[model samples]
Target: MASHLDLEEQEQLEQVKAFWKQWGNLITWLITAVLLAYAGWQGWNYYQRQEAAKAAAMYDALDQAVQAADADKAASVFNDLRERYAGTVYAAQGALQAAKVQQDKGQADKAMASLTWAADNASDDSYRDIARLRLAGLQIDAKQYDAAAKSLDAIKSADFAALASDRRGDLLLLQNKPAEARAEFQKALAAMDKTLDYRRLIEAKLATLGVAVPADDAASGAAK
Candidate 1:
C-alpha cells in the first residue's frame, strides 16, 4: 500500500512537469509583457505630470507679465513657453495675452506676429479663430483690406459664422462696397444668436446701411 501511494504521487509530479514544459515559457513571456506594459504606463504618467507642472509654472509667469503690462517680458515669456511647451494650451493663451499687451504698448507689428503664430499653431480651433479674428481687426486698422478678407475667409468653423459675417461686412464697408456690406451684415444678423447682445450690434450695422431689421429681431428689442 505504501508503494502504491508512492507511485501515485510520482505520477502526479510527472504530470505537473509535463504541463510546465508545455506552457511555462508562454506564461513567463506573458507575465513579462504585462510587467513591461505596466512599467511603461507608469513612466508615461510620471513624464506627463512633470511636463504639466513645468508648463503650469511658465504659464504663471506669462500671466504675471500680462498683469504687469510688461509687453517685452510677456513676449519673452510667451516665446519661451511656445518653444518649450507649445503642446500646452497655455502656449496659445500666452500668445493671445502677449499679443494684447504688445499691441497696447505700440508694438502693433509684434502683436500681429504673435497673433499670426497663435492662429497658425493653436491646437484648439476656437483659439485659432480668436487669434484670426483679432488679427483681422488689426489688419483692418492697418488698411490691409485684402489680408483681412483672407483671414476672415480662412475661418471655416460654423461656431464663428455670425462673427465672421459681421467682420466681412465691416471689411466690405471699409472698401466702399455698401451694397455688399449690407448683404453680409444681414447674413450676420440672421446667423447670430437671438439672445446675444452682440446681435444688436449687427442690427445697428444693417441700420447704417438703411436696411431695416425685422421688428422681432434682437436689434429692435435692444432699442426698446
Candidate 2:
C-alpha cells in the first residue's frame, strides 16, 4: 500500500510539471503586465499630485505679489506660472492678475494681450468668458467698436446673454444705429431678471427709443 501511494504521488507531480511547461511563460507574462500597469497608474497619480502642489505654490506667490501691489513682480510670477502650469486653473487666474496689473499701470495694450491669451487658452469656459468681456470693454474704450462687437458676439453663456445684449445695444447706440440698438435693448430686457435694477435701466433704454414695454413684460422680466 505504501509503494502504491508513492507511485500515485509521483504521477501527480509529473502532471503538475507538464502543466507548468505548457503555460509557465504565459502566466508569468500576464502577472508581470498587471503589476506593471498598477505601478504605472500609481506613479502617474503621484506625479499629478506633485505637479498640482508646485502649481499651487506658484499661484500663492502670484497672489502675494498682487496683494503687495507689486505689478512688476506679479507680472513676472504670473508669466512663470502660466508657462510652467498652463494646464492648471492657476495659469488662467495668473493671466487675469497679470492683466489687471498691466491695466492699473496704464498699459492698455499689454492688458489686452494678456486678456486675449486668457480668453483664447483658458481651460475653463467661465474664465474665458470673463476675459472676453473685459477685453471687449477695453476695445470699446479704445473706440475699436467693430472689434469690440466681435468679441462680445463670441460670448455664448446663456446666463450672460442679457449683459452681452445690453453691451451690444450700447455699442450700436454709439454707432448711431438707434433701431438696432433698440432691438438689442429689447432682447436684453427680455433676457434680464425682472427683479434686477439693471432690467429697469434696460426698460428705460427701450422707453427712450419709444418702445413701451408692457407692465406684464416687466413683471415677467422680474420673475426671471
Candidate 3:
C-alpha cells in the first residue's frame, strides 16, 4: 500500500509538470502584458497632470498681462500659451480673455484672430461655441455678413440654439430681411428659457417686426 501511494503521487506530480510545460510561456506573457499596460496608463496620467500644471502657470501670466491693460503683452503670452498648450483648457480660456482685451483696445482684427483660433482649435465644445458666437457678432459689426452667417451655421449644440437664432435674426434685420428676422426671433423665443431676462430682449425684437408674442408665451416669459 505504501508503494502504491508513492506511485500515485509521482503520477500526479508528472501531470502538473506536463501542464506547466504546455501553458507556462503563455501565462507569463499575459502577466507581462498586463503589467506593461498598467505602467503605460500610469505614465499617461502623470504626463497629463504635468502638462496641466505648466499650462495653468502660463495662463496666470496671460491673465496678469490682461489685467495690466497690456494688450501687446497679453497677445504675446496668449500666442505662446496656445502654440505650446493648445490641448489644455487654459489655452481656450486664454483665447477668450485675450479676445476681450483686444476688443477693448479697439484691435478688432486681433480680437477676431483670437476668436477664430478658439473657434477652430478649442479643446472644449462649449468654448468653441462661445468663440463662434463672439466671432459672428464681431463679423456682423464689421459688416462681414457672409462670414457671420458661416459662423452661426457652424453652431451645432442645442444648448446654444436660442442665442444662435437670436443672432441670426439680428443679422437678417441688419440686411433688411424683416420677414426672415421675425421667423428667427420667434424661434429664439420658443427655444429660450421662459424665466430668462434675455427672453424679453427677443420679445422686443419681435415687436420691432410688428409681431406680438402669444398671450401664453408672454405670460410664461414674464418675471415670476
Candidate 4:
C-alpha cells in the first residue's frame, strides 16, 4: 500500500511538471504584460500630473507679470510656456494674455506672433478659434485686409459663425465696401441669437451703412 501511494504522488508531480511545460511560459508572459501595462498607465498619469502642475505654476508667473505691467517678463514666461508646455490649455491662455499685453504696448508684431502661436498650436478648438479671431483683428489693424478676410473665412466653428460674419463686415467696411459690409452684416444678424445685445449692435452697424433692418425683425429681436 505504501509503494502504491508513493507511485501516485510521483505521478501527480510529473503531471504538474507536464502542465507547466505546456503552458507556464504563456501564463508568465500574460501576467508580465499585464503588470507592465499597469505600470505604464500609472507612469503616464504621474507624468501628466507633473506637467499640469508645472504649467499651472508657469501660468501664475505669467499672470503676475502681466498684472505688474512687466511685458518683458511676461513674454519670457509665455515663450517658456510655448516651448515647454504648448500642449496645455494654460499655454494657450498665456498666449492670449501675452498678445493683449503686446497690443496694449503697441507691439503689434509681438502680438501677432503670440496669437499665431496660439492659433497654430493650441490643443483646444475653442482656444484656436479665439486666437484666430484675434489674429484676424490684428491683421485688420495692420491693413492686411485680404489676410483678415481670409482669416475670418477660414473659421470653421459653427458657434462663431455670426461673429465671423460680423468681423468680415468689419473688414469690408475698412476696405470701403459698404454694400458688401451691409450684406455681411445682414448675414450676421441672421446668424446671431435674437436675444443678444450684440445683435442690436449689428443692427446699428447696418443702419450706419444706410441699410434699414426690417422693423419686423427688429421687433422680433427686441421681443426675444
lDDT per residue, candidate 4, 168-214, as tens digits? 99999988899999999999999988877788899999999888888
Tens digit of per-residue lDDT, candidate 3, span 111-206: 999999999999999999999999999999999999999999999999999999999999999999999999999999989998888998999989
Better of 2 and 4 by TM-score: 4
Compared to the true structure, candidate 1 yields what TM-score? 0.89
Q: Give the Cα error of residue 78 in candidate 4, in Å.
A: 0.1
Candidate 3 global CA lDDT score: 0.95
Over 4 Å off, model 4:
1-13, 220-224
Task: Estimate TM-scores for all models.
Answer: 0.89, 0.83, 0.91, 0.90
Candidate 4 weakest lDDT stretch, 10 residues: 146-155
Q: In model 1, what lDDT does residue 25 have? A: 99
Q: Is candidate 2 or candidate 4 better by lDDT?
A: 4
Clashing pairs for model 4 are: none
Every candidate's lDDT = 0.91, 0.88, 0.95, 0.92
Residue 86 deviation, candidate 1, in Å?
A: 0.3
Tens-place lDDT per residue, model 2, 1-224, is 99999999999999999999999999999999999999999999999899989999999998898788777888889888878889899889988988888888888888898889898999998888888888888888889999999889889999788888988888899899999999999888888777777787888888899999998977766685
Q: Please say which candidate is ahead in TM-score: 1 or 3.
A: 3
Candidate 4 C-alpha RMSD relative to the actual structure: 2.2
**Candidate 3 least-lDDT 10 residues:** 215-224
- Error (Å) of candidate 1 at residue 117 is 1.3
